[model samples]
Target: MSISRFDKKIQTPPENPSQNDHSAPEEAAQIGAARVERVIHGGDGLLRLDGKAGFISGVLPGELVSFAVLRDRPRQFEGVLREVLDPSPHRCEPRCPLAGRCGGCDWQYCHSEYQLELKKGIVAENLRRIGKIPLERESIQILAGEPWGYRERVQIHTDHRGRPGFKARRSEEIVLLSNCPVVTEEINRFLEDAASGKILLPPGKRLVLVLADGESPDSRAVIVAPGPQTAQRSLDGLPLSFDPSSFFQANGPLLERLGRELRSRIARDAPRVLVDLYGGAGVLGALAVSGSSAFSGDLLCVEEDRRNARFIEENLLRAGLKEAQIRVVSRSAEKALAVDPVLKNLDPPSSAVILDPPRSGLSATLRRWLKKGPAARLFYVSCNSATLARDLGEILGAYLIQDVTILDFFPQTAHVEVLVELRLKG
Candidate 1:
């Protein structure tokens, strides 16, 4: 179990040598070296040192690396990669000079194709290990585009000098940026303009910049900084009104693909009623089932934010769902289900539900309700796989997984968007 033999060029003492001594300070920022056993969900490499499991970012499996322990415990430690004593063959140089410092992207050290492989492996491992759902490696589908310049939305902060930048990794300190490589060209130009004083921005304010359309670089961008002003965008020709602070998908092409996939699945299932949970701007369900000639189902969007009701209604109308029964409930999913008569009387056989909950996944009450087989079909879109696996495991007795697709929404980063289709077990 020792990795000392793997590399002898650099030798360092483990953070803790005594297994039973638990009085060490929590913030033991010590330097140590270990061989990475595997990469985990958040793009950190898992390794063991002195009989204690540890995790360090900016590394890959089989690489012997030195790290600075940010947090040390009796059983485990969290650290940041300091140096690679022995590097993995799949490692590559990051495109951004500030990749290690800026918190914008992780896995920049990993090769592009290897990044996909790591994501697929992480997703499958999470499902198998956490949810007890096992599938062949080839069974999980992956949707990816170019590995760079795909982000349509970016939020930048202004330092005391009004310099726009992103926060450093694991710290509040702003890392000044001359340019960003992962954002769209338009955003990059805008940032450059702002940085060069061509575009004046308030100092010490959070600015949210988003393009009106991802594919059209010529389109105008909507920049908001603490105001009543809002902006409008389109999804598959459906008009969407959103502020810069809106939570729409950042990757445009892959979002369209996700919409198409959901549309095809919902159309094929022919659900008479469609319920969109945690419907942020009513984008997912509205754009998904829109323009489907076979879809004449009633639409219900439940969102806790009442301000989004107008946008939801507007998008639904733009989707040509005027004649169909459409209701926007501005309440949490749990409360909305209890108060709304339609949700209470939903016929599972003729109904479908789209669960795009937050990164925390479904609430316990909602999970319990879903476990009772509330819908015949379920489309669970998740950005966090760990929580997704936990929630899926709770309801597996009632629903069986039919398909799992990994969409590379955030490239050059540890983040991923997953779409899981489930069907009620008869």
Candidate 2:
């Protein structure tokens, strides 16, 4: 196997902690020593160490941990657990069977409430530290739904050799996964069958990404990214169809709340317009202002992927909405919102623009458009605060930060999906 580009790092390398090298232990190799730098940079109380990448494992920040070198390269080093000479106050036993091998959730050993705090701190740090933007989050709205079994999405992966399960972190090695502790029971059943090879995956496919709709196992949903088209079912009469490899919010109940969180900021007026940027299957735009009996309005969703745009268009028609009622802008958000004058003319003037950009956040041209556009309100949904904070700083002049809700959407992890509501300040 060839060494990947990320493997090249010049850090002090661990001499022996690996099975590949028998002479390492005796050499007393020199490796980079990074402080368990800070959880959420001190928010989560998580002690993720810095310095040489692969040299630290089984040990967290604030506690001395020597890493077991897995692979050493010029630019980076891969490591595994060696020894934890000391432990942090937040450290606890991990409940999952594959705690060490499974790449799903690393902080499962950490407590639940502590996990939420870590997420909060992570958001605050990304905004204030990385982005260098100030946000008074000490008293912010933090929605912690459930610590366990809250995940509505599950992705099952296997190796080419036909072993059923997920690949170990940073490697393609398959780990048998008959059950997942964090997901609902129904998903577990389906996953168990798939893992046991009872449900044969397409001949060569080795991945299964199951996206559920509601909090329970009974929630109807979609499956993609690995294979299989998606069909969504909801009591609210939502019939969603998605391609095999598109971006869809897997959490159903949380997604509804996410939509409600955005809707709470909008005025309850029919005929209102919305520009759903990166509107995967138009879910966000559909959430912003659904064509319910009590509400009547236009939703213009802009999706770059042609296949996703088709799904959005089909979903709207399935709901008995006029084709004109929902305009699927096949162009990029920037092109749709700016280069194409036709998009700005969708509704009288969009009352709100809801955006869910990729981890990289919004493009520069699109950010500038939102700042100067006619949208009265903006709902910025972000999965990564590092990027969000930076983007927020760029468009601060266009909108004022009215409220930020730190939702524990993804628990047992350092990731926090935040919702920021903004109204035009000037």
Candidate 3:
């Protein structure tokens, strides 16, 4: 069935209020069986129950499963997997014992190879449905690294007893875990050390661990407490440091690959000026300037957080750009575009802009600006495909989609990072 048909069925109201909300302590009687129609963006399988759309986790497309509805809405019902009557051939046992309970790795039940396929299909569907951009399967590139032990950064939530763990799926309950397999080996070692009293941890509600050098025994990682700390690391031979609170790409190898891709794409565009919006630690800005042989113009990194200015300055300095050539603006993207005189006169043919906004995508003002005054080359790095599609739909009138690449930054989970290249239409 087409996704459009499913959309129509979702709008249909439920026949009875009892079917809409089940507030009883006993919901087992409401269990129903349905074949999963498809997997949606959030990695939930879509199905139909009594002509109403149903969503359940831990199931695959085309699998017949029984589920218990946890929450019911007008159009769709959220459910939990009860029994897999007919499991998919690709199903495999999760590595972690807390697979279904811990919210860290939701797609651990599926094989690594099939996980990429599902993410690609979901991205394509979002582009076609939300962005109105129908892209061929072959044209969408996929780059992935090791499925396990690639994460360089992780957040560990704690309980009242100071036990380190992760939050459970869709609940406030904490799932205590001694170690996570998805993080780097060094991190796991640190966790083991912390658990075994080899290291002491200050009392905090949550802890953020960043592994800069896994091989170094002396100071391989920094265990950032509930305060400000600098996490130092290098990517693709570029020295970098950032506030633990600020954002940084988690996967190492995949991040390096992304750097190479950005450099190559920017070089092809041959932009004289480069602007990095939402520039965290100036990672992308530095990467683009360091490797691009054709890049000659000044580099501008606009970041809203004032605490990141020092890090951005240091990183850009190390990127080989002269001190006079690098400009760091401490302002939001919208404010910078509106107030900064330098950002107002961007040469369409010689300017390149990189957007790495939060999951909400571009601001409304920024979207309007891009649609009217889009640069020659636009590189958008997004973690949410839905927001990316929404932003692209608004700005596609002036920009042509060059290509979209999916990077499996968060393996064993439903999250996928996407990078899109756009060029202004002549």
TM-score of candidate 2 against the unseen true structure: 0.79
Q: Over the stretch 1-426, how does candidate 1's per-residue lDDT look in tens digits?
A: 437322332244343321111122344346667898888888877998787888777778898877666577989987656568888999887888887678898778788898888888899889889988886657889989878888888888988877789977667888888689888888888888878888778888888777774445436564554554456677677667765565767887788788889999999888989999888878887778788998887999998876666588877877778845688899999999898998899999998999998899888999998999989999999999989999999999999999998989998988977899999999
lDDT of 2 by residue, 1-426 (tens): 111112223344443332111123432333333335445532222222233334343334465554534446775564444344456777787778687666676577677876666666677777887667777658457767667776666666655645457666556666777777778666776677766887656534555465545446555543545555555645134556666566666556677776665555664434367667788886666665544554456667888888688788777766556787777778888778666554555432446677788888988887776667566677788887788888888777877887777867767655678888777765
| Residue 421 CA displacement from its true place in model 2, Å | 1.0
Regions of candidate 1 where Cα sits further than 4 Å from its true position: 5-31, 68-70, 213-218
Sort order, TM-score high to low: 3, 1, 2
Candidate models: Cα lDDT each:
0.80, 0.62, 0.79
Assess candidate 1 and give its lDDT: 0.80
TM-score of each prediction? 0.90, 0.79, 0.91
Per-residue error for 356 in candidate 3, Å, reads: 0.5
Worst 10 residues of 3 by lDDT: 2-11
Error of 3 at 373 (Å): 3.6
Error of 2 at 266 (Å): 1.8
